[model samples]
Target: MVFAHAPVAIAPLALISLGGLFWLWQKAETPFQSMQIGLGFGLGYFGTGVSWLISSIYLYAEMNLVLSVLAVLCFILFLTLYFILAGWLVARLKTAQRQGFNWVVVMPAVWVFAEWVRATLFGGFPFLMTGNTHLMTWLDGYAPVFGVLGVSWAVAITAGILLWLVQSRAWVGASLVLAVLWLTGASLKNVEWVTPKEKPVEVALLQGNVPQDDKWLSKEFLPTLKRYVGLTKQNLDADIVVWPETAVPAYYDVVERGALRSFIRDAQLLNTDILLGVITRDDSHRDYYNAIVNAHNPEQQYQKKHLVPFSEFFPFSSVLQPLSELFNIPFSEFTPGADDQAPMTLGGHPVGLSVCYEMAFGEELIDSARQADFLITVSNDAWFAHTLEPAQQVQDVQMRALELGREIARSTNTGYTIIVGTNGQLKAEIPPYETGVLRGEVQPYEGETPFVQWRQWPILILLLGVMLLLVWLKLQARPSRKTTAED
Candidate 1:
């Protein structure tokens, strides 16, 4: 899992790791032992895979080393519980009469279902989902139709089949099954689900390279504003010029009272749209929003709906105020935007916009993305500077692009400023942690991938339907026993 997730990003490692873990689960004498093995696997998997979490907590959250390490351990343990659950389930099933069927079919089902649960429950953490590891693999074609979870299903099933082959040596049957699964995806890769617009839109994605700790400092605010303004002016030739999340480092009113109008007018004069991120206030409602707005048309905006946990909003704030102060987190109370809000129109094209962590939640982006010609995610990843988190985030962005079959423009404050093509390939990129503009052409796509139309329902229904059918079959196979009360 660690090798497959990021920085390393080796796809086959995930398969080998999952298969080996499954083998251990089957080898365990009892489900309880299987769960213990799974707990260890989880510790290794997430402890290394998401090691970047320690960087974020230690740096931005301002937590002490002991507390940060403990906090991260708790998070890893939480993620590991799901793996333990899978292990217990697989162990019990592997002992069933239909051992071959259980290992090949039921195990994958268990793994993917757990993934879906992890992705949905507790506001979702959809990271290192395994499916994204296959982004460049033949199985990537499954994304547009089945979504990331579905692709994960394919990987798990394949891994299970490989495990079966190792034990049974039923080479022909396994080969045939693998051939069908893989070749089908290979064919699907060529099917263009979305058509491009007549004219491609030019985009200039700005990387501000602002230090996270210095972002909100009063002295740095004007310089940050000036940096973005200068960058936008230089890139006004683009159809849309974009700034990273919170590039202004100030509220809407603060910028408006200073340079907002002139900035908008400058873009308007050039017939360009500046899509930039900033904090917006609703004074009457006392609401704060992490938002992206069109400088040329402020009303054209998208407020981020999916907020990062703890930093965005404390899960149980009333009882956690002391914890919040200990961490020194900011923007902990920003209001989430309405789901049905209109997509932001940027550079004469409708855009599905995501901010920072929200890119990991595909459903959060899908509603607007279905109606959008393209997608743009503005993020401030400086909190995770010099870590795999940003590149890992890019992997998630690629998954979204492949799922939706639409080009994605990713703008970030610290690093990983890049454009992902509809095929989930990097079309263009600006070097990480650098101050620069990545100029690229995004072809607006006109149709929806199956995923964009149904979100995660197909995968869920398919998984649920299969398990239900299997349950019915198992019930039918059981012998009937009649019991009578003795007189």
Candidate 2:
């Protein structure tokens, strides 16, 4: 299953995805054929994209099976609208020759623009971003050099080459592009960007495997806490122990009974630091944050900057609150953290922390990695059980490590917990739906990556400028209307 471990190889699948739409558009023979093609592409892309929603709702949350399947289909169909627009744009821009000026440039631009649109529009579900799927393939070495945007660019270029081959039957050109990807991947396999200097730090990640339905119930609270604590106690020799998102269920202000603090103090007694996910509230009790708080130190707190749509907070809750809840939203009211939260420190090393869903945004995670020695994430995938979603999501996290040159320690409540190296290899991992802890040695590096220092914004601006400059030159080259008519 490409959807399982080898998710990074799915970029080529997009060719099948997009090409199928183009064929459909050819059959339609309509005025807005390009637009129709785009819609077709979107349908295929998102139809399969949101299939994980079935697992999330039915298997994980135990929702009614029929409604859960319907919900997943509806979500996928809804997300398909964006792909339609993407296809429309590409088709609409075709020159009189039935071919665009440069598909290489146009394809990447359109796809990147589409992905960006998908990430921001309608509260933005940026999951399964095409860029994330490139992790396992050596095509990802371009990540550290160009970020996910670069891999996205390469993917677009490959699409363009394929399109060109289709139009002109130029097999040589297509073969060359494929060869380049192969060679690049081969070269990257040998490249050692991060050297492990310090002795490996042993980490223990606790997966309580708490059922989503009972996780927040009063009766289940003690058992849930005990599950995590008991697991950590078993791994006391670990240098760092982590629990997945909201391992502590209630808001801290209400439940800060000092019980967790006492446990943290004991962990400190063991010379280990426990990084936990908990709900935190401000003095006014108005701002409740989805946060990662350290038990050993009161000073360190990592609040989640990116909150999930509908689940965290309805985009327009006042108007849609009733409708959102009617659909069984997980967390309908959560506060977002400030963008510039500092990386948390544990055992004297900077650990850049991001909550679940935050890892999907490559730029933000990479920027955070710039300052931190390693990357850490806490998640409760009790939302998406035994689906391609978690696998795809993990690949995204792995790419973040590769792009930013940081070690990743990801702990999930319902499994798929993994340890990834700077090169994006799964050095260690725990499977989905399993109750266990993953322990491994991680050597945090000190050197900075180009992506770590200079983020995606600079590269994007440069690309935009070049495209704009090209447009300006093309306008200048066009013959004057009067002269052309006289000729």
Candidate 3:
């Protein structure tokens, strides 16, 4: 499972690794033993997969070395609990007579639910979703139809088949099922869901590559602001110019209004719309926001709605206050943007918007993407500190692009700034940790993919329904109670 994501990215490893766990669940003599298997698998999987968290805690959050390790381990252990419970759930199917149904349907369904619960719990750590492994593979075709969870379903089902192949006598049936899945997935690859509009918007994404440590420094503030503005100034000829999240490095009001507006006015005069990130405070100053500023149209800005749990806001505020004191995290009080906030129009094109890690939630962006021509995600991932997190984030953006079948303009501080086409293909990008501008043309797509149209409702409903049906079958097969009882 750890090998499913960067920096390994071998697609087959996702299902193969999961198959091993399914095998263990089959072999366990008791539910507790299955739970033990889950515990061990969870420890190995999330321990290595989420090691980046320690860097975010120790280096960026500036927590003590010992505390950072403790915090990350605690968090990983919490995530592991989900799988531990899932293991117990899978073991419940062990006694069912329809062993084939148990493997083919119930096990994969449980795994899908586990993935969703893991992603949604505690503001979601959506790292290393099993579906994210099939970026360029045939299974990625499922992404457009069912979203990442659907892709996860395809992967999970295959693992179940592998489990059945090893343990059951249904060899030919399993082989045929496997063939149909892959062949159908490959055929779906040729399916086109979105109609691309004729005009392509040339976008200039600016990566200032500012060090996270120096980003808040008073000495570096002015230089960083000037550096981003200078980069934008050099790209005035593009249809749209963008900078990464909080590229302003100050409150929205802190920048000399005249100077900043003057630059925007100059760019507007040349028909360019500049979209950049800055922290902004609402009128009463009681509410602060991590927002995108539409330099050409100040009032038409997008604040981030999906706040990352720990960094942007505490999961349980009253309870986590003490933990905050120890962590000393920044941006802990940001107010989320409105759920129905309007998408911005840049370069005369409707654009879906996300700031920082908001790209992790595909459903949240669907509202913006439904009526938009393309998507934009501005992030500052410098805290990742040369880890695989940035690459993993790029994959998230790619999956979103595929899900919506719309091109994405992703600008980030320090690296992995990229242009993802509607098919989840990397069209263009600049090297991470380098100060540069990635100039590319993204063609605007004008239609909705099925995943965007229905979201995850169909898939979620189907999985839960199957699980309930299996429970009903189990109950029907239960031994009847004897009434010789009158005693």
Candidate 4:
């Protein structure tokens, strides 16, 4: 699972790891043993894969070291329950034939279903998904057609095939099948599902290397705002300029009549449009939102629809309020934006805007991107500073661009200010722990990929059909087993 992530993402190894998992499941003699095996593997996989959670909780939540570790463990243990259920289902569904139908069909189907459920339930995590490992591989071509979950289904099916090959020792047939699958993926990479709609627009993405410990300090707030404004001033020639999430540490109302207005006036003088992240509030309603606003027109804003759990809003605040107070968490409550909010317009082009963790939900972004010419996602990843979380986040953004067939401008606090092309390739990026402006031109794309138009329905339907077929086969075999017992 560690290797399945960035910096060492060996794509093929994901197949091997999952195949080994299925092979181990085949050895379990009882349902209890099967669930145990699944839970153990899941614990190890997620425990290492998402270990960065510990750093985020400790740094942002201000928890003690031991409590942070426990928090991470508890989260992983909850996620592992999905795998345990998958194991129990597989054990119930597997027929007497250990190596043929169950290994190649039922097991893979159950695994993919389990992954989909994990990504759907409880507002979803969707991190460290198996298909993310194939970002650089030819299999990534499948993204536009079937989305990430479809790619995950393909990977799991291939792993099941590998398990069958190992058991049957049919190296030649297995080799042919593997070669055919990869070659097909390679061919699919050449297809273009979306085209450029407008001339390239020059963009400047600002990365403010703000220290997380000092970011929320009262004394440092003005300095941090000045730093971003100064950095943005250096690239006013760009068509659009972006700031990281919550670039203004204070709320919009608090800064609107002061430094923020002056910043907007300066940008307007240069004939540049600026979009910056800030906290927005509805005074009459007493509601707060994590949002982005156009510097020139503060009225034009995009509120983040998908709020991060715990960090943005505590799920069971009534019950966990004491725990939050104990940990000294700031900004522990926020109301989500309306679900059907439209894309914000900037510089005469519709821009799909996502704040921080909102970009993780590809399906939700599809509506935002339907008429958008380009995409912008801003984040303050300083919470997970010095961890792989930010890098993995960049990769996830790249995949979203590929799936939607749109170019992405990702602005972030503390690094990885990037411009990604429609093909999901990095066009330009700033190094981590640096304060700089990544200047680049991104061509606005129109039209949608298949995944964008249909979303997850196609893949979900296919999986459902497979599960129904398995059930039918299981029922058909039941009568035969009874007849043999009577004979």
Candidate 5:
């Protein structure tokens, strides 16, 4: 799992881990022991994979280093229960006793289903999902057809087959099967699912590089706002310009009458459109939203639908709000936007926008992307500076582009402001912790990949079928074992 994340993402290493899991399941003498082994593996895998969380807690939350570590441990332990459950199910199904069925069919089904549950339940922390490792691999072609979970299923099944070959000492057969899988994936890469719709439009993505400690400070507010304004002016020739989440560092009403108004006026003069992240308030309802708005036309806006847990909005706020205040966490509450909100029109094209962590929800993005010509995501990653969090985030954005078959413009505060092509390949990027502009032309796409249309339904149905079949096999085997016991 650690190898599946960024900086040193050798994605193929995931197969070795999956193979080891198969071996563990085969060797365990009891269901309880299998679950224990699963728990131990989950702890180690997630502990290292998401270790970056500790940096965010300690640096941004202002928690003590010791408390931060303990907090991360508690979170890892809670997530590990999912793995434990998968192990118990695999054991209960007695897949190990079913030759030619356990490793190939049952194990992969169990593993992928567990991952799906983890990504769906309890607000979901879908970080480091297995298929994300295949971003640069041939398996990435499968993303458009079945999404990340489908790719994960493919990897798990391949690993299970390799485990079977190792146990049976059939190295030649394993090599052939592996070659076929890789070759098929490579061939799929050349298939273009979505075609270009309009002429390419030049875009300027700004990386403000604001320090988290000074971002919200009253003394630094004016200077930060000026910096972004200056950057926009520098790239005014582009058809569209973008800023990171909370780039304005003030309420929409407050900024709209001040520098924001000037930005709108200047953009209109240049025949350019500007999209920026800001905190918006609805006075009548007294609700605050983390939203993106068009500086040239504030009426065109998209509020973030999916909010990050404990960061944008705390779960069980009535119980956790007091504890959050004690820890000095600011801006920890936000209301979600409507699920059916339309895409914003910009630069003669419809744009799908996601604010920071919302980019992780692929299904949520599909609705907006269905009518959008291009996709845009804005983020402030300073909370996780000096960690792999930003790199992993860039990868996730790349996957979204591939799944939707649209070019993506990603703007960020303090790192990885990148432009990705419709094929999920990086076109341009600004270095981390630097103030710079990523200038590129995004070729808007017109059509959808299979993933955009079907989403997770196909994969879920396939997994469900596999589970039911395994249950039937177990039931059929029960009577045979009883007869042998009677004899």
Candidate 6:
């Protein structure tokens, strides 16, 4: 299976998991064998997922290389615990007297519930969701409405149907389901929720290609500022221009000194609003924030609500502080911004802004999108370097755009600057590590989606209702079994 490269690593991982699930469905004949398959499957799924942790530790922490490897292993093992429990639950349900629930409901239930556990347990690592693999295909239409969780549901249901076909000769039913899904996808293909109004807003995204090593150093600050300003000057006619997070090393208050103020004044004079990420001091004496300052109105500012653990803000600092000091990365003490701040208006258009790490959290972006006309995410991906994470991250961003029916102007410090339309289409993008201004005209869109109206509460209630009905029916079928089990 490993030698067959056509299916890829994640496919192998899923296949291993499917093998374990099949063994569970067949009654395994022995508890040890059932648990053994579960363990192997859990390792396959998590071991591949945690490969990025090694890069994260090495890049973010100055830990010894060997220690970083060990950290990756430990993190993967820790994540596997959730999958292990999920495996055990599935096996238990199979062993129960309820034969009807064995494969039909139990498999899908455990799969969806296990994914929920994966998303929320241990501070949540919602990356690499199985639904993400279908992003390049017709299944992407389901993403805007259901988010990743919805995609996961479809995947699990398909898997269940496959199992049904194998056991009960339900090929016709499985084929019908597949046909309906494809037809629904086709119908959703051109169903746009919002129409663009007025002329497109021309914007420029400046990618400085700045190295993370020297981004914050005193000597590199002036050169970095000059590079961004030079790019901005070339595209000043654009309605709005943006720079990546911390594109300017100093805070807005600090940048007022010397020629910085004059440079900004020129930008404002050009009648274009320039939005750039800046570090700023809050009312509290020692508190700092990773924030975006609006040069258009001057008074309007939006700060990042969700801070990255360890990199932006440490959760358990008392314990992690010593380990952080070992890295020696500067200005890492970041404070979380208010969750209720209003979106900033640039060139008469409301722009919902998110700093680097905030993009990882879908909830915050969804909330901000509701109140704003457009979406803007500024990030510095120098930490991830040339890893597949950036590409994967943009895919998630596109999903958010489709979900919200809003245009996004995503600016990055190093590379992968992208603009996504409401349909999850890549409007414009710069090549990774390319140093240039990606100038494009993005039209503002308006309207609401099902996701925007009800959020996930409706889906949650529906799932709960199904579970309750299933349990009640099981109870009605076998009153004696329930009594004996309780006894």
Q: Summarize candidate 4's per-residue lDDT along 319-376 as a digit string, tens digits.
A: 9877777466556688999988888777678888999887778888999889799999
Q: For every model shown, what is its TM-score relative to the native structure?
A: 0.95, 0.87, 0.95, 0.96, 0.95, 0.87
Best by lDDT: 3
For each candidate in turn, give its C-alpha RMSD to the true structure in angstroms: 2.4, 3.5, 2.2, 1.8, 1.9, 3.8
In Å, residue 40's CA in model 4 sits off its true spot by 1.0
TM-score of 6: 0.87
**How many residue pairs clash (N, CA or C atoms closer than 3 angstroms) in each of the candidate models, in the order given?**
0, 4, 1, 0, 0, 0
lDDT of 5 by residue, 261-326 (tens): 776766656677888888998976467899888887778888988888877788899988776763
Q: Candidate 5: worst 10 consecutive residues by lDDT?
A: 94-103
**Candidate 1: deviation at residue 471, Å?**
3.4
Instruction: Please write out the lDDT profile of model 1 over residues 418-480, one tens digit for every residue.
Output: 999999999999888889999999889898899988888888999999778666766676566
List runs of model 5 lying over 4 Å from the truth.
64-66, 97-100, 171-180, 480-486
Q: What is the lDDT of candidate 2?
A: 0.72
List, residue by residue over 1-487, the lDDT tens digit for candidate 2. 1332334454567655444444444344453776666765666666666676676566655567886777777777677777667666555433344342346454456667677677767656767666665566666777886677777666656666666677776678677876786578567656666565566678898888898878868899888888888998898788888989999987765555655656765655567888878888888988889988777674688888888764687777789776554455445588899988888878678889998898877777765777777888989888776656777777778878877788888999987788989888888987778789998877787676667677777667866774575466556667999989999
Candidate 5: deviation at residue 348, Å?
A: 0.3
lDDT of 4: 0.84
Q: Between prediction 1 and prediction 4, which has the larger TM-score?
A: 4
Global lDDT of model 5: 0.84
Candidate 2, TM-score vs. the true structure? 0.87
The CA-based lDDT of model 3 is what? 0.86
lDDT tens digits, residue span 1-487, model 6: 2211112324434434453375465576554555565666667666754465556567665668887777677777776676667666565555356433455566666666676677666566766666655554566676667666666566655555566566566577667886777567656656776777667888998899998778877889888889988988898888888988878788777786664788866665668888877888855648888888767656777777877766676778887887776555566788788988888887678778888656655655777888878888998877777665676677667767876778888999877898998877789998878788999978887777766766766556755675576666655666696688999
Clashing pairs in 5: none
